[model samples]
Target: MERMDGVPPEGEGLKGGTHRRTDGQVGQWRGVFSPGGGLQPLLPPPGPPQPLPYFVRRSRLHNLPVYPRLRKSNRRLTELRHVEGDIWALERELRAFLGGRGGKEPEVQVNEVTGSLRFKGRWEGELREWLLQRGF
Candidate 1:
């Protein structure tokens, strides 16, 4: 590329690449810019996988829930990956708790159109209130 002075910009350096004739080893990399341009590492290298929460070592109830149960009344709880305890898991846990063994427990059907989770049957606002209190 021609410079404003009509000379190829930075030709005194690499012919078009960064390296020293003394050694083929990589020289100072150019444009080590970060997301907002700082002298920090251009990109963070892959880090070790994060360890699971110590809560996992506690009782089963302390572990994360399968997903955040959004009730018909509208509420937001901890992420689906971090929910535990409270009445959020009740609907799905009931059949197992009662040993219904009818080969089917209540299922929560997610509405594809409205993005809502509905129970196989209503709990007379019980489930909705419980989830709301816990921000589910």
Candidate 2:
């Protein structure tokens, strides 16, 4: 082979790492021997961005009594929903049957012996006398 600086070229360097020709020619390996082409530097792959999480609050049944007006207002406000094939409409229609609206206060019924106060309101199938017995 040929002498590159002080080191002697291996007899068959093309089979190894040395840049040399097989025919004892003095050319550096390259320019032709590589079938697929030249070496390329390794690279990293690209990826998607991280996403954020979503959250929500939960509710429980104990809070219903805290808003008395809201609790009572549900039926009055949505009177139509309470009506329909059901008997709620009948209850509303018969509300006037409860008594006269003479005073601002809701009608009160007091037991003669027990003296307990009771509020009365109409129901779907119950008789009219139950209101005088119960209170509103």
Candidate 3:
């Protein structure tokens, strides 16, 4: 019998065709297999998984008083009231912290005039914990 390519179906004259390894291993191949019939060492095992920054010790929020209040209306929002310093700066820091924690950064609407920040989510618990850690 012949295949569409006109080659014998018995794999005659074929070179380097797929065949079982002499090692009797099954399934897909992994790592480098040398011509010496010995499996070379695989790449060094990956390093330990990294922990999120949130899990680490919390640093104090110096000179920045954060009072997070949860306000629920048509939407859930975390309101940072009585902020003694720049609200925009707080927003930037919060964004960086949340992003570092390996989660999507939540949207923050800053009311410069009111000196308050509206974070779009029910992050009351997280905010409270973050603030408490900062010695709020």
Q: Write the per-residue lDDT of candidate 3 for residues 1-136, one digit (tens) a residue.
A: 4333322343233222233445764323223334454434334225653333222121232223334454656666777665645566667877787667677999988876766677877666676666654544
After superposing candidate 3 on the true structure, give the runs of residues whose Cα lies further than 4 Å from its correct spot. Answer: 1-74
Which runs in model 1 stand beyond 4 Å of their true positions? 1-104
Instruction: Give the clashing residue pairs of candidate 2, or none.
Output: 118-135, 119-135, 119-136, 120-135, 120-136
Whole-model lDDT per candidate: 0.36, 0.28, 0.53
Give the candidate number with the greatest lDDT. Answer: 3
**Model 3 residue 58 lDDT score:** 18
Between candidates 2 and 3, name the one with more favorable lDDT.
3
Highest TM-score scorer: 3
Ranking by TM-score: 3, 1, 2
What TM-score goes with each of the models? Answer: 0.22, 0.15, 0.44
Candidate 1 lDDT by residue in tens digits, 46-97: 5643332211111133322333445557753322222223323443444353
